[model samples]
Target: MKELQDKISKKLGFGCMRLPVRGEEMEQIDDELFCKMIDTFLAQGFNYFDTAYPYHKECSEAAIKRCLVERYDREQFLLADKMPIWLVKEPSDLNKVFETQLKRCGVTYFDAYLLHAMNKDRIRDAEEKGAFAFFQQMKQEGKIRHFGFSFHDKADVLDQILTNHPEFEFVQLQINYYDWDSEAVEAGKCYETAVKHKIPVIVMEPVKGGTLANLAEEPASFLKELHADVSLASYAVRYAASLENVIVVLSGMSDLEQMEDNISYMREFCPLSEKEKNAIAKAVEELKRFPTIACTKCRYCVDGCPKQILIPELFESYNMTAQFGESPATTRLYRKAIKDRGTAADCIRCGKCEAQCPQHLEIRKLLEQVSEMFG
Candidate 1:
């Protein structure tokens, strides 16, 4: 009951992962646009902002420092910067990363600090590097107000981490209506596990990185029937936040329109009506009609792809191609991204990628579809 009642007002955490990019490079966050977006976010009373050392183009933390810390008062907004264990190679590297984040954010202290993107491997690495002790030290030093982790792993891994470290104040998970029953993510299962352990959940990508918002005909039409004014994006974020123990739901608001629409939902937050819930469930069921992989470009497949083509990216193009019909311009961009990577022609029919795939996807077949669509 305490967890439910302890709703942080405007718990709309601004995710700095996918900020508005300049052309193909995510490194270049459009300063004018992003600053405007930030200004709008702060003015509206939403406080939490999330960024990490390598969130955007491997230079996102610095962008946050420039755009946020220097711009907003320290007490007005809460900032959460995560320690990137995956990027650390040594035990001492942990301190280096932690300090780097502090320098990058240009803040003496962090409102919330998390062990970023804890998978099984990252968890193991953190254990070896005395990660928990480091957070304990930071807490004593007053550098961090709260300590936690953002996770993307199986429920067993989540359980292991939570049980092993009950001191963590919260857990961040990717939760959304589309990912509820998704085998590739199992967000619902992860959410339930957090509840059993009585941990507050910070939801990231509640709208599937805008994938749910820019829906196809079936979902768009179906949701339009439910509430003409309510965007499909609203249903996704609301569904995630409505879950038990959710402390905040983070949205990667890249533009003014997205920021306004999302904040609107936060202010007049409404729990999903039963009819609304059914509409969402039905909408998700309809979304599976599109043949897109769950490849979130988490960089899991990058190393395994023998052809070197960015597989997830090609899928993004594939979805767009099907959505907008054949336009030479669309295929041209896809071609440029894959030109050096050898189009889909260089897929060696090797099963190494398939072995590592959590989706158990038929990668070779996907390449053919990709080639036919864009080549």
Candidate 2:
């Protein structure tokens, strides 16, 4: 266990969920730019790269193959992947998907493997499907070196999972200052639960899917007054990394510029000072004044929407209007979000989206608000 932990000693991990894309298409990865970003990330001695089955419409694994795995020596980096247990229809589907992920990434073994996006319902599904046993088997066979799960849902659900499955070595959580005490995310409670179980945490959405990075005017200005030059995103990432139990902070950098910006601060990592902590506290309160949708753009709700509503993009448009007030740019963004997809008014209220949402957002009701605002 100590040996494996040594391999992933770095605090910053390259999240492949939002890799640079061509135009607006999710799967259209720009190989040239992606290669440059990876080269720079590794050149700076940051070696961990995380990917999953469903990222980028299922193209992320292959992109990693071409950009990282095939280009760099296997021992040069630590790779992490997740099993989409929800897609496991039967027992055999487990090995089938694992083997496919291996082939997709062109790797014989993964440094870290996780049960993706686990919640209370999915926890039951994992137990009934023998996912835990499968993970043990994979570890023994050298197919996986470390095993855990990425979590969503409440802290109580997290506590239950950790209590029930102490074998899990670590947990990936959605942790950021903005959502730290949020009733919806409950990041603070969840972090404490993981610590209580002695499981180290790997933080995802540390910037709240770029929400904290691009703060609304008041919070942004408040943070700037304290640290005039630092990026707003850096404060959020450092906040997560400051936690003693957290092993790594994953940033879904979409371009070379974003990657460089992250590496600039994280290269010589520093925990937040007393004043910085106080600044973040003030910023969080200021941000809560705006009635913006707390969508992290995870896009989990979009996959099951029967109307094929571009849920996250629409929410982004709504947040812009809510924060900055109505403007031509907001109107254009809303139009672009609805183009070739279901509009907010077209929702059938089938509840599939709400069921799948990690934030437990009242998405149907939120869509109604979006419709009224944009219509």
Candidate 3:
């Protein structure tokens, strides 16, 4: 574990996916705020940063160039980039995409480069395009120090990938307390698979894209009961970091406050106690009581929505109603959520949103339910 920590500055990695934005437009990143966050992050000795091609509609990489890469020396931090294999139309498209990423980030080489968001479908496409060999060749050429892949598939797929390509030094995974037992995500099973293959794991979504951090009362209360001092977000992050196989826990902190809080807990790392672990397990059960929509609010559904229905916003309101019981304020918020945008009832059942969703949610049915409840 110490060996892994030595490779990077700290266990906490700054994920660039959800950087501070100027307004409703995600592409318009708040550079001043982002720079402060980056400064604090580096000042505190945390170096690792993870970004991908599709984050913030391709602006995230450029934002990193402005807020991070341009400000800091190359040796000051280790940047982890990804190859968007899904974007490749043909084999030659790989070179174009990688070159674009380099130009966007204004960097010659990435410290850690990954095959981004490799699910079964993307993996199949990557194989067809010989992406695995391309990444290896890049590593051989000293373009990428550590060549790995960020995964988003079943244990069997992970197992297959590891079995076939034992050369990958590490694997990035979505591991959190909420999804540990999730049948759909199978976070625990996937972690176990990575451990079985002797691959060091880099954890993403430790806070479940800010879901676990903003817990609905029951789970929050459980953590508070255990240790009132620590932030609720700390437990989620600590759980991921505590695992021996997990080298870095990537937290998508949007502002300075979030960075400060994370750094406070992680600067001097402490693993969760046995009692806290049990409490977390119980808290997971408490969370299961509410049939809340499992949307990570990645907004993959929003970009192409024909009706322009703010799917994540509606789901948040719906989750509030489900977890806290329906209240007048919640209703008012739900109304406001659907005000300017198309209401849940406006969904034409095109299934575009559902098709794009990473969680594979029955979005149409969920939207129908939201309409029924809030109508």
Candidate 4:
């Protein structure tokens, strides 16, 4: 595994989920910008790219094929793709999807392939469909070099999965500081489970989907005082990278500035110091003081909301006012966000939003709070 780590050489991997888009359209990926970012990433000596079936509304794989696979030599970079196990209807659907993934990525074989976004229900579905055995056979057939699964379940489920199928070479996990000790995500325990099984860890959501990157003023200020130079995001990425078993930390770089910022710090990789960790601890303590919404801005709730509330944006405004006391400004922002859609008070308690939320938040209740605060 250590030799495998040395083979890749760089600790950063370009995540394809949030590729730079042209204007407000996600499907229309900015190819020129993406090409530039990839060029810089390669120039700075990173060699890993991770994409999935559903990222960018199913466009991420094809974009990487055009921007990366077509431009760079196959040996110059390693590509990691995934099977959308949830989309599989039966066991035979697995191979059909794998073939499509390869075709979409313009590759004969993937360097790494994963079972995308597994929880207990999804994993069980995969098991019933014999998806795990399918990947193992694919490995034997030289279709995939490394076979693994990206997890979104609890520690106990992770333990069961690893114990039941130890063939997985690596486990991609969400491992940011905010969710490190979160009872909901159980990130800390999940990481520990992977380590216990000697599975090499590949980190996803190291910035908590940009939540840790764009910190609230209080914690950001504390970190600024300590480092004075590093971006708030650097601390989060570095913290994930510093862990012993983490082989790659994926960041979904959105623009040239973000790409350069990531390259600047990650080009010369360094671990977080004890003093920096202490600062993060203090920031966490301070963050706990606010009645802030614990939203990662994943926008999962938005897809199912009948009222079309811009839930994440509203929560951001709520946070700005409630946590940082930027009320007037946040009030204005809130009004603007709700201009074309439903306000916090407009939620009809349909229960669809809560059902879809990965965080299991009482979104109905939270919306009532947002209404009280800003309505």
Candidate 5:
């Protein structure tokens, strides 16, 4: 276990969720730019690349295969993929999905394989369908080097999963300064629980899907005043990396510029200084003054929305209006988000989105607010 931990000790990883896309089409990856970003990430001594079955409208796996797997030696990078447990209807579906993932990524084995997006109900479904045993079987066959799950629940739920499945090698968690102590995310409590279980953690959404990076003026100014040079995103990533139990902090770099900025600080990683920690605390307090929707833009809600609403994008536009006040720019953003898609006013209030939301957001109610603001 210690030897395996040493192999992935580099604190930075490349997340393939938000690859640079052409225009508004999520499926159309900008391959030239993505390849360049991958090259830079590799050159900076980072190896871990995280992708999932549903990232990039289910195209991220193949994109990684072409850009990274086909272009470089297998040993040059560590690839992690997740089994979409939501797609499993029976035990046999596990092998079927796993085989499809192997083919999609064009890899014989995965460095890490996780049960994607495990929560209370999903955990129960996975266990009942023998998903845990399947992972162990894959590990024994050398198809998976490390087996675990990415979680989206409170601390007690995490504690339950770890207790029930002690065989899991690690866990991927959503950890950012904003959500660290949040009642919905319980990131601080979740991290503590994983530590108690002796489980190494791979952090996702360290910047809260660009929320912490693009803070409201007051908090953003406070952080900038503390460190004149560093990017706002770097502080959030560093905060997650600073934790003792974290194995890697995954940044979903959309372009070369973001990748370069992340590499600059993460290459020679440093924990937050005492003053920096206090500064983050103050910033968090300042952030609370603005009542923005706490959407991380995971896009989990979009896949199942009956109206096909771009829920996260609309919330982002709404947040811009809430934080910086409405303007032509914010109105244009809202229009762009709903362009050729379902607008906020088109929502049917069916509640599919609310069921899948990890943050447990009142998405229906929030969409009404978005409609009122931008209608």
Candidate 6:
């Protein structure tokens, strides 16, 4: 296995955002499955777990406590948690979140604690809401070993944060071959800025929310033709980890099979060899052939919208409609778009979302089209 640090070995960090569940609700956390996954993970010599305040919507930290922390000694693994500032309104709530996170995890301290989901709006809100001071206070109190944030914003905001908070130990970013130069995501520029800031990187979404897994037929066949044992996903994770200054590559393992596959490959980590690297290098071009709106899944526009429309899924459905021309798949997704939430038709063009969107998408216009198509 590749040693990230002598202090704590890193193979692939376990991201608990989309843990496997039974039916619809996440009340039951698949303990037997998750514990088996963790046991297999540790047996293979991998030990980094990343959980957030609202991962799986208030279930991640507690799941880790049961599936991992409670079962293993503190010294045996490294735990990473985040202070979810987006969930907060008042400044006093910062300490409350931090304290409650510690309590829920049943851990005295965190190896790495980050400000989660830090886009431009969230970062501004954090500073104005006294999160920085509270973060510093936690560091001084010995509650946090290292302080950082997971970001989803433009390069400038990243630069500003790194310049402003040089003391932060690392930055977690959504890095993958597909999003490297994407206008919607720009993973390359993000990674470069982090490198320029001399900040170590922890990569998330290397497989792009399982988007890479369900490739179109041609690419799927191409990948299948390449390797019999490895999956289409292994190439993606290998590509992300091949970058410089990347200390951790996190895959949100949803089940035992996924956990095993990721662990097996990451255990004896090797940089993608010349040919495999070249093949993965062509992923962006291959991905461009697919009909997809350049949505990065950042959800910045949805955050501040008065209408609360799910903009990302709108584009995703549109892309699906455009590509596959499949009525059932696209329409089912479209109907589900507003089944429990707002739709494009409700957009009043308050422009709150436009201001926060790092991609500079003409969200007002997109909403108009979405309303026309799906309303």
For all predicted structures, in order, the TM-scores are: 0.90, 0.98, 0.95, 0.92, 0.98, 0.86
**Superior by TM-score: candidate 4 or candidate 5:** 5
Minimal lDDT window, size 10, model 1: 1-10
TM-score of 2: 0.98
Q: After superposition, how far is residue 229 of candidate 6 from its true place, in Å?
A: 3.9
| Candidate 2 ranges beyond 4 A from true positions | none
Q: Model 4, which residues run further than 4 Å from truth? A: 1-4, 326-336
Ranking by TM-score: 2, 5, 3, 4, 1, 6
Candidate 5 residue pairs that clash: none
How many steric overlaps does candidate 4 have? Answer: 0
Better of 2 and 6 by TM-score: 2
Residue lDDT tens for model 4, 195-280: 99999999988887787777777778889998688788898899899999999999998898988888888989989888889999
Model 3: per-residue lDDT, tens digit, 1-375? 234347697889999989999986789999999999988888888899999998998899999999899998988988889998868999899989998999999999988888888888888898899887788788788787888898877888899998988888889999999999888888999999998998899999998878888777767888899878878899999999999888899999998888999999999998999998998998899888878999888877897988989999899889888877889978887887788799999999999998777677899999999998788
Candidate 3 stretches with Cα past 4 Å from truth are 1-5, 326-336
Clashes of each: 0, 0, 0, 0, 0, 0
Instruction: Give residue 183's error in model 1 in angstroms.
Output: 1.6
Work out how many backbone clashes candidate 5 has. 0
lDDT of each: 0.80, 0.92, 0.88, 0.86, 0.92, 0.80
Clashing pairs in 3: none
> What stretches of model 6 exceed 4 Å from their correct place?
1-5, 26-28, 294-317, 327-375
lDDT of 1 by residue, 1-375 (tens): 242224345667898888887886777788778888888888887778888876775677888788888888887778888987867787788888888889888898887889987888788899898888888998899898888888878888899999888888888998888889988788889999999999888999888767788787877887889889978889888998787578789998878888889988887677788988888888888878767755554445556676787777777777777766668866776877686775676788877766555444677798798888765
RMSD of each: 3.0, 0.9, 1.9, 2.1, 1.1, 3.4
lDDT of candidate 6 over 1-375, digit per residue (tens): 122244457647888877888775656688888888889888888888888876666887898899898999988988899987867889998888888999999999998889887887788888998888888888898788788899878788899989987777889998888888877677899999998988789999888877786666666665666786688888888888888689889999888888777877888888887877666656556767875655645555765777678888888887677667758878999988777778887778888887766456778887776676665
Give the better candidate number (1 or 2) by lDDT.
2
Residue-level lDDT of model 2, residues 230-277, one tens digit each, is: 899999999999999988899999988788889988998889999999
